[model samples]
Target: MGSKHVFVVAVIYSLCAVAVASNPCVSTCAGRPTGDYQSRNGCNVYATCVNGYICDNRPCVAGTVWDDTLKRCEMTSTTCPPNPCVTSCNGLVSGDYQSCNGCNVYVTCNAGHLIDNRPCPSTLVWDDSLRACARTSSTCS
Candidate 1:
């Protein structure tokens, strides 16, 4: 009976070992399988290869700063502007539309540009003559 118990314990131990070996490491503390470990570059951990980099062993590319805000690699000089305007007009007299507001301003440049609506309405038109937003029909020019 003693020998049988020992045999059973040995069998259980062998099975547990096989199971552990067959399964991938559950935590990073234990060394990973041959090709399963991730690469560490700077403060970033890459799960897989990107661009031309090899799996589990590539360094961070130059000129790229790790962005904690975006949680990825980004160029150091990449400027995030507060408000980007697509269209801007200059040199307005008293009646011209000086600036377009909002995230995107689509405008066709003319003497005093008409934007959004045809012969743009007073509200939307950018009056180049006035140097300030004015009614399209006001006609600073």
Candidate 2:
């Protein structure tokens, strides 16, 4: 291959390496206090960071996924959203809305800002249509 073609291929290869080798905790836990933190890579995975170092990566209990809002593992039978908590409240009217993270959690928004993330009562799930915590029937999945 010509020199120019070689350079372009090398640059593209480097970019691909960077894209595939990212660790979600590297950005999420940096400068944060020592504690368990959720990993954006997967719902069942979490990480423990201590003094800017990822000391451990752990999995949630079977049948559960890490709940970033609640800071704990929560049960879920359905497939998790690909990119949870990526939904923005900006430009949205103030109201209770289903969280992008899990079905059992909801977010409170005010004037286009996210105020809080709250979990539905145990054994219940947030009902987006009703905008309330209701008994989980078939929709929680």
Candidate 3:
């Protein structure tokens, strides 16, 4: 019985120590705002600035404009362009934009449309319904 109690106590202590060591920062600390100096509590807690204002060195300041669409802050009197999908129409077929590549811009076929010139077996015909070149009939080849 004594050994069992000692083992249980050791297990509880180990669990508590692991929990404490995993998360060392408190939830009430604030992060420093961009273009502002770092505050003492900036690195401690996870607080943020209120709407229409930004946290500067753990303090809130006015005149900090926020781009609600972008979910980021910007300087005053800054103008952002409209949505890319609306303006550029690149990669848009009918009304949809393609997924982004690493650095190259390209268009993606929307529903019911297929990419042209893909390799297909001579016996099979390109089927837009299947999104791949498939045999028109099983007897084709």
> Number of the top candidate by TM-score?
2
lDDT of 1 by residue, 1-141 (tens): 697666444432332222223322122333333332222222122233334334532333654533333534455312211111224323211121223343112344344444532244435534332223444412222
lDDT of candidate model 3 versus the reference: 0.29
Backbone-clash count (model 1): 9
* Clashes, model 3: 2
Each prediction's TM-score versus the true structure: 0.17, 0.36, 0.18
Backbone steric clashes in candidate 2, count: 0
lDDT of 2 by residue, 1-141 (tens): 997666444432332222223322323466788887655335566667788788544887866766555667788422333223315565444566567678878887666687556888888887553457888622245
Q: Cα RMSD (Å) between model 1 and the true structure?
A: 27.1
The residue ranges of model 3 lying beyond 4 angstroms of the native Cα positions read 1-116, 137-141
Better of 1 and 2 by lDDT: 2
Model 3 clashing residue pairs (backbone): 29-45, 29-46
| Pairwise TM-score winner, candidates 1 and 2 | 2
**Ranking of models by TM-score:** 2, 3, 1
| Winning model by lDDT | 2
Candidate 2 Cα deviation (angstroms), residue 84: 12
In candidate 2, what residue range of length 10 has the lowest lDDT sum? 15-24
